[model samples]
Every structure is written in structure tokens, then in C-alpha cells.
Target: MTEQSAPGTDRLSSVATAARILREFGKHSTQLGVSQLARRVGVNKSTTHRIIWTLVDEGLLERVEETGLFRLTTTMRSLGASAETAQRLHEAATTPLDELRRYTAGTLHVAILDGTDVLYVERREGPGAIPVFRSVGSRNAAHATSTGKVLLAFLPAERQARLVEGMRLSPKTSRTITSRPEFLAELQRVRRQGYAENRGESEPGMCSVAAPIRDPLGQVVASVSVAEQVESVDAGLRHLVAPIVETAARISSGLGWNR
Candidate 1:
């Protein structure tokens, strides 16, 4: 029993150490070396080398032949694929997004919260639409845009405060809301109304309106927004587009989102 337990404990320790090493490597992938990784992870050189060698063997880490530096492997692609399959937010939002684009004749975007940022997962550009600055795979600050505001409004207050703490509310345009108190008030209003809007806050003359897409359980899982040039967005345009944006949220909700 003792002999068996000894190997098991050792294996667990190695795994713990390996996980730490991998985390450090991920944070500094461009310039990570075995010595630096060992120091950062609080493990000794020999153990770090053994752990790295094991990860490299498993194709989770790669060694650059030229500089002998270590980085993540192509196997990370498989992890990303698995995440995409699991999330399915983009797939769920597709049809509604098409309808939104048809209704608004502007750019429609679907995004999910990633840490303190919103990651664009899908987009549909309308015919004759002006080119948008954001693209799929781009990330934007959560406190500064419409989609981000809707999503953040749904999060618990503590979580929202924690996420925004130390984050710069950088001004992207003269119209952008950068003060934390004002931004928090806006988020509260979004929570009450079930949607949010931005008037050229991210980019000059680019206005956007967004609604939260919730799961069946009422949890905000993503957001859908329509962006257009400010010159084109009048009071009449808001009346036409808001309902379409809400409709898109409903469609995404039907795809298994709750709230």
C-alpha cells in the first residue's frame, strides 16, 4: 500500500507542477525558457525540465529549434476547436443575426464576454453597409460599447466591479463615457431596460444598439448589436432597429439560452 501510494502522490505533484509551468509558459510564450519557467513556477531546474519534456512529448508544448525556447504547441488548436464546439453561441445566433442585418441594413455583431473584454464571435454586414472597424475574433473593452454594456449589466455587481477594477476606461472618442460612476449608472439602466445603446462611444460617428441574449435559464450568455454611422441613426432609425435587435436576442435565447 505504501509503495503504491508513493507513486500516486509523486504523479499528482508532477501534474501540479506541470500545470504551473504551463500557466507560466502561456503568460510569456514568446520568451519562455526552462530556467525562467522553473523560477517563475517555484520549481527546481531538473523537475521543470522533466515536466516540460513530458508536455513536449504529449504535444502540448513545443521547443523552437533555433532559440531552444519553449512555447505552446499546435495541439492548442484542438483545445480551441473543442471550446468552439462547446460554446455554439455563434451557431445559435446565425439566423437571428441574418434577420437583424436584413431589418437594419447595417452591421450586426454577436459577441460573448471574455474576461473583461467582449470577443466578437459572428458578424453579418448589410448590403451597401459602410465598412465596420470590428471583425470576428476581435476583442473590445466591455465597459465602453453597447454589446459589452448589456452583458456586463447582467453580471453580479461584485463580479462586474472586480472585472473593471484597474482597467483603463480609455476614451476611444469624445463621446465615450470613461468615468466609472457614470458607466455604472448606465449599466444599471441597461439591467432595468434589458438592453443598451452606444452613440459613437467606441469609434467616432459609429453608433450601436445592443440587447442581451440569454440562455433558457435567464443567464446572459451573449449579446447582439447593430452598428451604423451616427449620421444615419435618427430617432426613426432607433424605432425601426430596436425591435429587430430584441428579436435577434429572442432567437438566440431559443437556441438554449435561458434569461
Candidate 2:
């Protein structure tokens, strides 16, 4: 028999559902009426009004005067500022990252973990590089990318478990390790090795190696990676790139990562 759901699951589900409605509004920002939002979210008019009002009072959504329509507010400015800060930090690491690229002649990327995804903060292409598959502001599954795995490996056990629990481990390629047990084992290996590598896990014919960037407090705040064609990322080449990637990570960490 199937196990019963936990207490508070329904409440959490409702909040998540409501939050998804607000996110849709944030994406569109077309000034939706309460009725429209209610229809869109498949909720009753009273519930939609209550959610909208709560969000408005919290400064997350704004109501248009005279029109009775609402849109996302400047409170999202905080999220933008955070992204800006992360970009600035990536800029600060450019020197080291550039040095790493020069040394390895491979594409370099800086990324930070966001929820269960890795957001690329910056990227520098190397000589004769293959067309980059990722770019600044692009996101990918955290479990499939080298940078993502490094960051995830550093997260607290409970937090890591929570991130993977009940989530679909969708395979991006034949080589992608989508099994939870195998993925956890890989995380353990990353924790022991202090780095991680993805051999065409996300993109076919591409390989990437990454090292975690720690904050001053020793927390893993970001990651630095070098991506190259699979044929170019052999064991010998990995040895050459590891130290450079680690150096770039250290430089970024010095900028204010707390352990």
C-alpha cells in the first residue's frame, strides 16, 4: 500500500501553487486583473484576491491605480541586485579565469548554484573554442554539470537530500547519471576529490571540469570550470587544468566567500 502524505503537505503545496501564479505574473508583467489571474491560476476569485492582496502588501506585487490590475513590483529589484553582485564578483575573478584559459586554452565559465539549477554568471571563450552551449543568465540542471556537481557536493547533507528528493532525474544524454544512488555516490567522490568532472553528461561531445569556490567562511558560493571537446579533455589535460581552475576558485573565494 502507498504511504500517506505528511502533515502540512497540502499547505506547502498551496503556497507553492500560489507562488507559481505570482511567478507567471512576474514573467508577463502585463498588468493582470484579479479575475484574469484567478482564471489563469485555476483558483477561485476570493482566493486569488487574497493572495494578490498579501503579495501587494508585502511589496512583491503592485496594483495599478484606477485599473484594478496588478503587476510585479520593484521588490524584485533585490533579486536583480543579487544577480548584479554575482556578476561583479565574476568580473573580479576574470583575471585568474583568463589566466586559466590562457594556460589551458579551454573555455572558462563561472557559475553559482540557484535552487536545483546552476546559473552561469560569466564565460570566457578560449582559442579555437567550439561554440559555447551556455551563456551568462543561462541555467542548467545542477546534477548534470561539473560546476553544479561541485557546488552541490559542498551543500549540507540534509539540504542536498532535500534538493534531490522526489525530483525527476531526467537524463540529458546517454552518459548522464540520473540515478539517485549513483548521483549521491558521485557527490561523495567530489567531496573527497575536491572537484568534479562531467564527460558529456549535459551536452554530447563536450567535457567539463570544475572546482568549488569557497567564501571566507568556507561555504561553497560558486564554481569555476573549463569546458572543452571531449577528445581534448583527457587525463593528462585534466591534470594541467585542475590547478588553474582551483586558483581561479581561490581568487573568487577571497572576494568574500565565508567557509
Candidate 3:
């Protein structure tokens, strides 16, 4: 009788087999042969062939010069480099983030644009931190937060346009910008002002101000923001711009951004 598996077991096993095959590459060799990999991973030659081609299509692996040998691609190297850079970015932001939170008496955030969402990577809470943003590893809509706006504002024009074109523009509050044309105009204003604002866009009575953090190449890699729940949010967030911009600059400098 054929062995039975639960629903989706075949897909899960394929994924796990693919992962095992990938791990096998660096352990004993840089380039692997299909038959050799199949023997090592204990998968059938046919299944291993299918998974290897899938990885090749995804640019994770490439065949070696008309040979059966397969090796990891530059895409794998880039993915590894990105992981290291993300760690360095958090380390570079720490002292500046703490100082900014203390100086401004507001909760500080460091975020990156993740797809159409803003992924919060670091946070320092002051006494005035808003109740809604108490966690560091949370994600929020990109169109409804200051950090998201600042990161989006600094993106290259064509890429930014494409991203905006694909956005759903879902609203979190009445103050959120939900129109593509108006959102594009807002990004233009942010580019001119060199900062962005959130006036109760993500949460009721919450306000924030944000500026871009650059890498060594002067490309915007992240954003820093000061957020709080204020009674008079519109005017209250203005003063934070100076300190937020300065702190962002300090973090950028720490990351070796000279321009």
C-alpha cells in the first residue's frame, strides 16, 4: 500500500527537501550535482530535479557552464548581505534613538518599507509613548504613518510611482491619505520639506514627525520618527521635526552616510 500523508504534506516535504538540498551545497561542496545531491538528501532524482530547477528559476541557484553542477547565485549573497546590513542598521540607530527619545520626550521608532507596509524594527519608549505603538516588531500600513511616509518619499521617482500605483490605500483613520494622486502630491511635499508628518492618521489623537536615515551611499535605508498621543496633535508635532531630523542625521552619520 502507498504511504499516506496529511493534507499539504507533499508540498511541505518538497519545501523541506529543497531546503535540505540547499544546506547540502555549503557543507561539502560549493557546486553540487543533481544525482549527488539526491543521494545525499535521500530524495528521488526526479523530485530533486524539479526542486533544483525551481531554485534556478527563483535565481537562488545557477547551473555551471553547461554542466550538471549547480551553485548558489549572487542573489543568495545579496540576501545574506541584507541580513547583516539590517543588524548593522539597528546597531547604528541605538544611541541616537535613545538620545532622541530622551531629548524630545517622545517614543522613537526606526522602520523600513516592507512591501506596501512599514515594518517597525526598533523602538525606544519615553513617558509620552502612545498606547497604540508600544511594541517594536509590529507592522502598520505605509500610507498612515510618518516613518512610512518619509521612507516612501525618499524612494526613486519611477520605483516610487510603481509602488504607489500598486498600493491599496486603505484608510486607518479619517486623516489618512487614501487617494493615489493626493498621496503622490504629499510625497512631493515631503521631498521638499525633508520630513513627513502623521496627524492622527494611524491612531486617534496620535501624532508623529519623521525623517530619512541614509546608508553609506546616501540612499535612504530607513526612517526615524518621534510619536506620541497629543491633545492638540497638529501643532504639537511641529517641534519634533527639528530634533527628529537631527537624530536621523546622527543615525545616518553612524551608518557612514557622508552625503
State the lDDT of candidate 1 residue by residue for 61-170, as single tens digits. Answer: 88889999888786664566536633687667766666654467777777888787888877787654535445788888887788899988999889988876756889
What would you estimate as the lDDT of candidate 1? Answer: 0.75
Rank order by TM-score, top first?
3, 2, 1
Candidate 3 TM-score, C-alpha based: 0.77
Task: Please report, as a residue range, the 10-residue window in candidate 2 with the lowest summed lDDT.
Answer: 232-241
In candidate 3, what are the lDDT values of residues 1-259, reduced to their tens digit?
7689777766778888989988887685889999999999998999999999999999889999977699989878666656766797799998888777556777888888888888788888887667777687788888889988988999999999999999989888888899899999999999999999999989988899999999999999999988887897667599778888998999999899985
Model 2 residue 214 CA deviation in Å: 1.4
Q: What does candidate 2's lDDT look like per residue over 85-109, in tens digits? A: 6966666787777667546777777
List per-prediction Cα lDDT, in the order shown.
0.75, 0.77, 0.87
**Which model, 1 or 3, shows the larger TM-score?**
3
Which one wins by TM-score: 1 or 2?
A: 2
The positional error of residue 240 in candidate 2, measured at the CA in angstroms, is 3.7
- Alpha-carbon RMSD of each model: 13.6, 13.4, 5.5
The reply for model 2, stretches above 4 Å from the true place, is: 1-81, 128-132, 232-237, 257-259
